[model samples]
Target: MVARSLLALCLAAVAAAHGDHGEQKIIAGPLQSLWYNRLPGDGGTQADSVFSGISTFGRLPYLPCLSHKDITYDIAFIGAPFDTGTSYRPGARFGPSGIRQGSRRLNLYGGYNVPLETNPFNSWATVIDCGDIPVTSYDNTYALHQIEEGHYSILSRSPATDADKKGPSLQGKTLPRVITLGGDHTITLPLLRSINRAYGPVTVIHFDSHLDTWRPKVFGGSPSEVASVNHGTYFYHAAQEGLLRNDSNIHAGIRTTLSGPSDYENDGYCGFEIVEAREIDTIGTDGIIKKIRDRVGTENPVYLSLDIDTLDPAFAPATGTPETGGWSTRELRTILRGLDGINLVAADIVEVAPAYDTNAELTTMAAADALYEIMSIMVKKGPLSGLEVEAGDDL
Candidate 1:
């Protein structure tokens, strides 16, 4: 009887506590306004360009080349939706769609934390969703050509007539830049070709688990066969083609088990520096940042190629060749923030294979978030030009 009475008293106390703190529910209409009205029901009709998925990057106006009579933008967001190059997993071909879907709330559309320093989506940066390049998965050589040509088409477009950094894209400078939504890391080589046309041979800041500098295999009298070309060997081709500066090129967060000593020896021969994934824990993100900045410096234009597998499988499980241990998402964000002031010419975030993703679309969501940071770097215009974040002192 004494125990029963005590239990009853405890239940009564819990009920009382709940009653004391219980709050009234907020009405939906007012709630939407406070959050930029970017919720599903808050959207305008699909036909409404203002509210359409193709028109905005996250509730920000999308402004595709077809939407306006003056179809020019400062930055072109292009998608290379071909995953045929993937060696292990086969779903990165869906990277663009997955990334764009996850990008729904990223802009002012109830997105979390808009940078007070600069808004890349606003009038200051004319960003266009150039849509995906149609690559026939069967033809690897043609697909690569299509990818390169797609970038060229966008790059060749005159920048918004007025690229006023202070105003809207219609008024900003014609600094035509392209950000590729990758099907795989191989997409970077094609993208590098286009960027090099715009800004000479660039210093590449490669973020991945593998060196990606493997030599190409010649097949059936032609090296151009799709089978001969793969996601792993593009960096090697890039160096030989003079598309990327060999000496200053660097690879970060790599933790893959190399096939042989010659593998790393080849990477070194290709003029690439590797920052092992374990080093993130040892040198810390700050140390990694200093090393990257030191390597790229201020002279050479930089191209950043990020393979999602560089992140630990725990944080990014949906990549093609996921390694066991790698950098966490937080570490990547911090490192990217540190690179704010570096001269960024072009970039891509690849290897997001959603087949292995969580039900919550975690991998796709991470890809979107990583793309957001990459866009933020572009908005800042150059290294040290963005969000004035202080460097962490830990190594």
Candidate 2:
């Protein structure tokens, strides 16, 4: 029996060397592999599931829109990894990546948005992730300019949608929209500047636990002009820069303690009507939604900026500032859905500091899902206003 086993082993080795084993045939067509089974580009193969591939927002195609002007997309996700402006926390600079990581499962369940009755990722719009803007950690002035220029670079591109398409635009051309992932709330100032260049002045729907319109002086003035722009004071600068539409913009979910009553007065002067966090208890989500819709109207371009801290800390703890008694995740999602037909030109989800989050990654996940809702509304109401696109203007 031992001699028979040895002879069989020798024969098997000889058959393996000759690539001819009984009942084990090799298939011919290109070596019969799964490696080439993917769609075009680096989007990974069909075998590479959600948890494995590169993390782009919603697992969308990552295009470097800044340099690749030829590639047209209807909507883009750009990350602003600048958190130097945070007063309470310093780690939100990583918010962009954290938000992207949280967004890994966004398209996992077939990318359907049931409430809006549409699938944004598979709709008429061509969505892509433009990666993150290169921001400097040392210099605020140059960093802000980089952010503004980076945002404008993407904003000025020709959209994949047709010129005659019903969507946002400027200068008689079809323009694309962007959803910015926060480095911190300070990035909004530069973003507003970029948006102002595209659409004259837009009404802002500011959702946060604190009113961000605090004057630099009120917020304990910064030594330099660039230093003056923090998460708490960007809206003030935005107002001063004429980027905000007066009496039309609104701030919801405010619950933070202020230095004095003058803070509210100043917030008003900065062109915002406050909807305090406590009001959700009395008026309910629909009432809050009505207030936002009424204040923002449906005609003009609207920029919705949502800070993660807008949700109660229990729901989203990984933010620069956490305030109690904020809206629940469900309530905020409902409110966002209520703004379905509004002319949402651009929007942002900011202040997702993953370092402070629980092991469940609650904050970044909430931010990503909120952005999903925002994208749903944006896609549902395809640039209802007939503004034209800007052809590569970086002003």
Candidate 3:
């Protein structure tokens, strides 16, 4: 056995040295006796191994649309690639594709292993990539409505059958917990609209560099010239729609230059408490976690929206509104890891503009890493065996 093993190892090394060429897949010649598979990008095809057919957010199946009756999912991954509302940078429109491309190299099975013990995909539930919504351009009103309609269509058929009222609160539940890849932060507004229709008001856990509650930051006439519907003011509208539980809603990692004195007061009026970017250092990671947990509480359903700019420009410089000083990716990951067992109904990771990313795609990769962490948190939400049971009913 020892001699045979040695011989096999020698043959494997020789085959590896030969390099992959043409349409060859198997280890040819002297290496023919062994079976060594490669990853998707390991010189073979787009479809290979466990990583085959990978999609954004992770190696999830890409469904043409989420409304497919044959397949029911516990999680849905969708993209919103419209970025006309971006105030500074215009390329967030490509964020979805960039984030997706950046995730191609990552292992989807327990991709977030450092923070958790298990791969959510391995034991928890099922997930599907619902593809991207073809958001309308130019017409901000139609664009938002299109986004809202797309989200609503998915929520209308989603499994979250129950609604929660207070902290650590959960009503009844189904799956298809939505995870959106963004065109920009404005996507959150329409997304909240969909969530409100299905699950009612939820606690919004916002991670971003800006407060995003400025009502007069519109592009027209003056601050309040046109409707306050840009990427900068979605939370204000969400508040007006009563889609959020204002007091329970919280913002983390804010480092933006506030427009005026009332910015803080305005955010408070919108029903949100602010956690400045520097607070991460002042409060420490654990302290920040404690504050977030304490503020959001455990009763109500929660919706988490992460803007990649929450990280400092040094780590994530591709966002429209990059902040000079902010939390490190490690700190953010630690904070997210600590948020286990929260009744998280849905989440989104937005503003990864690859156009301005490093050659290594540090910004997009950071966003991907965050998405994986969120998946780990979802794993802690108890075994989703019920989702499987529910999905089986149709068969």
TM-scores for all candidates: the values are: 0.77, 0.86, 0.79
Q: Kindly list the per-residue Cα lDDT of model 1 for residues 1-395, writing each as its tens digit.
A: 22223333544564566664422221212111112222244443222233343422443333334323345655667778888887888999988877777676675343333542555655355565767777888888888888888887776555653433321112221346678887987788788787666555778999998888886652122256455568888887788888876678789998877667788888887788889989977889999999898888754457888898888888889999899888888888778877876767567889988878988877777777777777777766632123121222110
lDDT by residue (1-395, candidate 3, tens digit) is 22224444644675577566323233422211122444335654433444444454565545555445444455667888888778888888789888877776556333436557756544445555678887877777788888888876765553422222111212234545778888888899999988777667778999998888887543222344235677888888788888887588889888888667788888898889878878766779888888889989864568999999999899998888888888888989998988887778789988878899989889988988888788768766753322222211211
| Residue 284 lDDT in candidate 3 | 90
Q: Candidate 1: which stretches are off by over 4 Å?
A: 1-56, 63-70, 108-116, 161-174, 217-225, 382-395
Q: lDDT of each model, Cα atoms only?
A: 0.68, 0.81, 0.71
TM-score of 2: 0.86
Candidate 3's TM-score reads 0.79
Q: What is the Cα root-mean-square deviation between model 1 and the actual structure?
A: 14.7
**By descending lDDT, how would the candidates be arranged?**
2, 3, 1
Candidate 3 residue-pair clash tally: 12
Candidate 2 error regions (>4 Å): 1-46, 164-170, 383-395
| Model 3 segments more than 4 A misplaced | 1-55, 108-112, 158-173, 217-227, 383-395
